[model samples]
Target: MYYPGQEAQLRAAMAESEAFRQQIEANHARGPAEPSAAPAGSTADSSSGASGGVQTQECPRCHGSGQCNGCEGTGHKDVTDAVSGQMGEKKYSSEMCRTCGGSGKCQLCGGKGRTLPIW
Candidate 1:
Protein backbone atom coordinates (compact mmCIF):
# COMPACT_ATOMS: atom_id res chain seq x y z
CA MET A 1 0.00 0.00 0.00
CA TYR A 2 1.16 3.52 -0.82
CA TYR A 3 -0.22 6.85 0.30
CA PRO A 4 1.43 10.10 -0.60
CA GLY A 5 -1.13 12.13 1.35
CA GLN A 6 -0.65 9.98 4.44
CA GLU A 7 2.88 10.39 5.73
CA ALA A 8 2.67 7.51 8.17
CA GLN A 9 1.62 4.99 5.52
CA LEU A 10 4.30 6.23 3.21
CA ARG A 11 6.96 5.86 5.87
CA ALA A 12 5.80 2.34 6.68
CA ALA A 13 5.81 1.38 3.09
CA MET A 14 9.31 2.75 2.64
CA ALA A 15 10.53 0.79 5.64
CA GLU A 16 8.95 -2.39 4.29
CA SER A 17 10.50 -1.81 0.93
CA GLU A 18 13.91 -1.29 2.47
CA ALA A 19 13.58 -4.49 4.49
CA PHE A 20 12.59 -6.46 1.41
CA ARG A 21 15.53 -5.07 -0.51
CA GLN A 22 17.90 -6.05 2.25
CA GLN A 23 16.46 -9.56 2.32
CA ILE A 24 16.93 -9.90 -1.40
CA GLU A 25 20.51 -8.77 -1.15
CA ALA A 26 21.17 -11.29 1.57
CA ASN A 27 19.63 -14.08 -0.46
CA HIS A 28 21.76 -13.25 -3.45
CA ALA A 29 24.94 -13.10 -1.38
CA ARG A 30 24.24 -16.57 -0.03
CA GLY A 31 23.70 -17.87 -3.54
CA PRO A 32 20.76 -19.87 -4.87
CA ALA A 33 19.24 -22.67 -2.82
CA GLU A 34 20.12 -26.29 -3.50
CA PRO A 35 17.71 -29.16 -4.18
CA SER A 36 17.90 -31.96 -1.66
CA ALA A 37 15.76 -34.26 -3.77
CA ALA A 38 13.39 -34.49 -6.71
CA PRO A 39 10.38 -32.74 -8.19
CA ALA A 40 6.85 -34.10 -8.67
CA GLY A 41 6.01 -36.60 -11.44
CA SER A 42 9.36 -36.49 -13.17
CA THR A 43 12.61 -38.23 -12.44
CA ALA A 44 14.29 -36.47 -15.34
CA ASP A 45 13.82 -33.20 -13.53
CA SER A 46 15.04 -34.63 -10.28
CA SER A 47 18.44 -35.68 -8.94
CA SER A 48 18.08 -38.84 -11.00
CA GLY A 49 17.12 -39.03 -14.64
CA ALA A 50 15.26 -41.61 -16.74
CA SER A 51 18.29 -43.85 -16.60
CA GLY A 52 18.35 -43.59 -12.78
CA GLY A 53 21.60 -41.65 -12.72
CA VAL A 54 22.32 -38.36 -11.04
CA GLN A 55 21.99 -35.43 -13.39
CA THR A 56 22.65 -32.11 -11.73
CA GLN A 57 24.55 -28.86 -12.04
CA GLU A 58 24.57 -25.36 -10.67
CA CYS A 59 22.03 -23.41 -12.62
CA PRO A 60 23.82 -20.69 -14.55
CA ARG A 61 20.57 -18.79 -14.72
CA CYS A 62 19.53 -19.15 -11.06
CA HIS A 63 22.97 -20.00 -9.69
CA GLY A 64 21.67 -23.52 -8.96
CA SER A 65 18.19 -22.65 -7.71
CA GLY A 66 16.44 -24.36 -10.62
CA GLN A 67 14.59 -21.24 -11.65
CA CYS A 68 14.17 -20.11 -15.21
CA ASN A 69 15.56 -16.69 -16.09
CA GLY A 70 12.73 -16.22 -18.57
CA CYS A 71 10.11 -16.54 -15.78
CA GLU A 72 12.26 -15.58 -12.77
CA GLY A 73 11.91 -19.05 -11.26
CA THR A 74 8.13 -19.30 -11.63
CA GLY A 75 7.32 -22.46 -13.54
CA HIS A 76 4.41 -20.73 -15.25
CA LYS A 77 3.98 -17.38 -16.92
CA ASP A 78 1.13 -14.87 -16.96
CA VAL A 79 0.07 -14.04 -20.48
CA THR A 80 -2.69 -11.98 -22.05
CA ASP A 81 -5.50 -14.17 -23.26
CA ALA A 82 -6.84 -14.03 -26.80
CA VAL A 83 -9.66 -11.75 -27.88
CA SER A 84 -13.17 -12.88 -26.96
CA GLY A 85 -16.12 -13.16 -29.31
CA GLN A 86 -16.88 -9.48 -28.81
CA MET A 87 -14.14 -8.07 -26.58
CA GLY A 88 -10.49 -7.67 -27.59
CA GLU A 89 -7.53 -9.07 -25.64
CA LYS A 90 -8.65 -10.62 -22.34
CA LYS A 91 -7.05 -11.06 -18.92
CA TYR A 92 -3.72 -12.73 -18.20
CA SER A 93 -3.31 -16.49 -18.26
CA SER A 94 -0.66 -18.77 -16.77
CA GLU A 95 1.22 -21.45 -18.68
CA MET A 96 4.27 -23.65 -18.15
CA CYS A 97 7.63 -22.10 -18.92
CA ARG A 98 9.14 -23.79 -21.95
CA THR A 99 12.70 -23.01 -20.88
CA CYS A 100 12.44 -24.62 -17.46
CA GLY A 101 9.76 -27.10 -18.46
CA GLY A 102 7.46 -25.96 -15.61
CA SER A 103 9.80 -27.31 -12.96
CA GLY A 104 11.37 -23.98 -12.01
CA LYS A 105 14.71 -25.64 -12.38
CA CYS A 106 17.81 -25.19 -14.48
CA GLN A 107 17.50 -27.50 -17.43
CA LEU A 108 21.27 -27.88 -17.41
CA CYS A 109 21.21 -29.08 -13.81
CA GLY A 110 18.13 -31.21 -14.14
CA GLY A 111 16.52 -29.17 -11.34
CA LYS A 112 18.97 -30.51 -8.80
CA GLY A 113 19.80 -26.96 -7.74
CA ARG A 114 23.47 -27.64 -7.40
CA THR A 115 26.28 -25.76 -9.09
CA LEU A 116 28.63 -28.31 -10.49
CA PRO A 117 31.99 -28.21 -12.17
CA ILE A 118 32.29 -27.28 -15.79
CA TRP A 119 33.13 -29.96 -18.31
Candidate 2:
Protein backbone atom coordinates (compact mmCIF):
# COMPACT_ATOMS: atom_id res chain seq x y z
CA MET A 1 0.00 0.00 0.00
CA TYR A 2 1.26 3.48 -0.91
CA TYR A 3 0.06 6.94 -0.01
CA PRO A 4 -0.52 9.73 -2.54
CA GLY A 5 2.28 12.01 -1.35
CA GLN A 6 4.52 9.28 0.03
CA GLU A 7 6.01 8.49 -3.35
CA ALA A 8 6.88 12.12 -3.99
CA GLN A 9 8.51 12.46 -0.60
CA LEU A 10 10.43 9.25 -1.13
CA ARG A 11 11.61 10.42 -4.50
CA ALA A 12 12.71 13.74 -3.09
CA ALA A 13 14.60 12.02 -0.31
CA MET A 14 16.27 9.72 -2.79
CA ALA A 15 17.23 12.61 -4.99
CA GLU A 16 18.67 14.56 -2.09
CA SER A 17 20.59 11.52 -0.92
CA GLU A 18 21.98 10.92 -4.37
CA ALA A 19 23.01 14.52 -4.69
CA PHE A 20 24.74 14.42 -1.32
CA ARG A 21 26.52 11.22 -2.26
CA GLN A 22 27.72 12.73 -5.50
CA GLN A 23 29.00 15.79 -3.68
CA ILE A 24 30.81 13.65 -1.15
CA GLU A 25 32.32 11.55 -3.89
CA ALA A 26 33.48 14.61 -5.73
CA ASN A 27 35.00 16.01 -2.57
CA HIS A 28 36.69 12.71 -1.69
CA ALA A 29 38.06 12.46 -5.21
CA ARG A 30 40.16 15.53 -4.51
CA GLY A 31 41.65 13.54 -1.60
CA PRO A 32 44.38 14.68 0.72
CA ALA A 33 47.38 16.31 -0.93
CA GLU A 34 50.85 16.68 0.47
CA PRO A 35 51.87 20.10 1.66
CA SER A 36 54.28 21.99 -0.57
CA ALA A 37 57.89 22.29 0.50
CA ALA A 38 59.74 25.48 1.39
CA PRO A 39 62.08 27.20 -1.00
CA ALA A 40 65.71 26.17 -0.98
CA GLY A 41 68.01 27.72 1.66
CA SER A 42 65.08 28.63 3.87
CA THR A 43 65.73 28.50 7.61
CA ALA A 44 62.35 27.32 8.86
CA ASP A 45 62.20 25.71 12.25
CA SER A 46 61.99 21.95 12.71
CA SER A 47 58.49 22.46 14.10
CA SER A 48 55.90 24.66 12.39
CA GLY A 49 57.82 25.78 9.34
CA ALA A 50 57.84 29.30 7.88
CA SER A 51 55.28 30.86 5.57
CA GLY A 52 57.04 29.55 2.43
CA GLY A 53 56.55 25.96 3.49
CA VAL A 54 53.27 24.19 2.99
CA GLN A 55 50.83 24.19 5.86
CA THR A 56 51.84 20.91 7.45
CA GLN A 57 49.43 21.28 10.29
CA GLU A 58 45.73 20.65 9.98
CA CYS A 59 43.48 23.68 10.33
CA PRO A 60 42.55 24.03 13.95
CA ARG A 61 39.31 25.66 12.96
CA CYS A 62 38.34 22.91 10.50
CA HIS A 63 40.80 20.32 11.79
CA GLY A 64 42.22 20.09 8.23
CA SER A 65 38.92 18.53 7.29
CA GLY A 66 37.84 21.62 5.44
CA GLN A 67 34.34 21.41 6.94
CA CYS A 68 32.51 23.66 9.36
CA ASN A 69 32.83 22.72 13.03
CA GLY A 70 29.40 24.03 13.97
CA CYS A 71 27.80 21.84 11.33
CA GLU A 72 29.89 18.78 12.13
CA GLY A 73 31.39 18.97 8.63
CA THR A 74 28.00 18.80 6.96
CA GLY A 75 28.49 22.35 5.70
CA HIS A 76 24.77 23.01 6.36
CA LYS A 77 23.75 24.01 9.85
CA ASP A 78 20.36 23.07 11.29
CA VAL A 79 17.72 25.62 12.07
CA THR A 80 15.40 25.22 15.03
CA ASP A 81 12.42 26.99 13.48
CA ALA A 82 11.36 28.90 10.42
CA VAL A 83 9.43 32.17 10.32
CA SER A 84 7.56 33.01 7.12
CA GLY A 85 10.07 30.95 5.13
CA GLN A 86 12.95 32.58 6.97
CA MET A 87 15.51 30.45 8.78
CA GLY A 88 16.53 30.58 12.41
CA GLU A 89 19.79 30.07 14.27
CA LYS A 90 22.05 27.36 12.90
CA LYS A 91 22.24 24.11 14.77
CA TYR A 92 23.75 20.66 14.33
CA SER A 93 23.34 17.05 15.36
CA SER A 94 25.88 14.23 15.65
CA GLU A 95 27.48 13.25 12.38
CA MET A 96 30.51 11.50 10.93
CA CYS A 97 33.91 12.99 11.74
CA ARG A 98 34.97 15.40 9.02
CA THR A 99 38.69 15.14 9.71
CA CYS A 100 38.88 11.41 9.04
CA GLY A 101 35.48 11.20 7.41
CA GLY A 102 34.43 9.16 10.46
CA SER A 103 37.68 7.21 10.54
CA GLY A 104 38.76 9.19 13.60
CA LYS A 105 42.20 10.00 12.13
CA CYS A 106 43.99 13.22 11.35
CA GLN A 107 43.84 13.71 7.62
CA LEU A 108 47.04 15.81 7.42
CA CYS A 109 49.03 13.25 9.43
CA GLY A 110 46.96 10.35 8.11
CA GLY A 111 46.27 9.79 11.80
CA LYS A 112 50.00 10.05 12.54
CA GLY A 113 49.79 13.68 13.68
CA ARG A 114 53.31 14.23 12.24
CA THR A 115 55.05 14.15 8.91
CA LEU A 116 58.27 12.34 8.05
CA PRO A 117 61.31 14.14 6.72
CA ILE A 118 62.03 13.99 3.00
CA TRP A 119 65.45 12.61 3.68
Scored against the true structure, residue 31 in model 2 reaches a CA lDDT of: 44
lDDT of 1 by residue, 1-119 (tens): 54468998778889999999999777656643454444422223333333334434445656656666666666776455555544454343378877877777667756555644445
- Segments of candidate 1 deviating more than 4 angstroms: 1-57, 78-92
| lDDT, residue 93, candidate 1 | 38
lDDT of each: 0.59, 0.50
**Number of clashes in every candidate structure?**
7, 0
Instruction: Show where candidate 2 strays beyond 4 Å.
Output: 1-4, 33-119
Q: Lowest-scoring 10 consecutive residues by lDDT in candidate 1?
A: 40-49
Error of 2 at 68 (Å): 31
Candidate 1 clashes: the total is 7
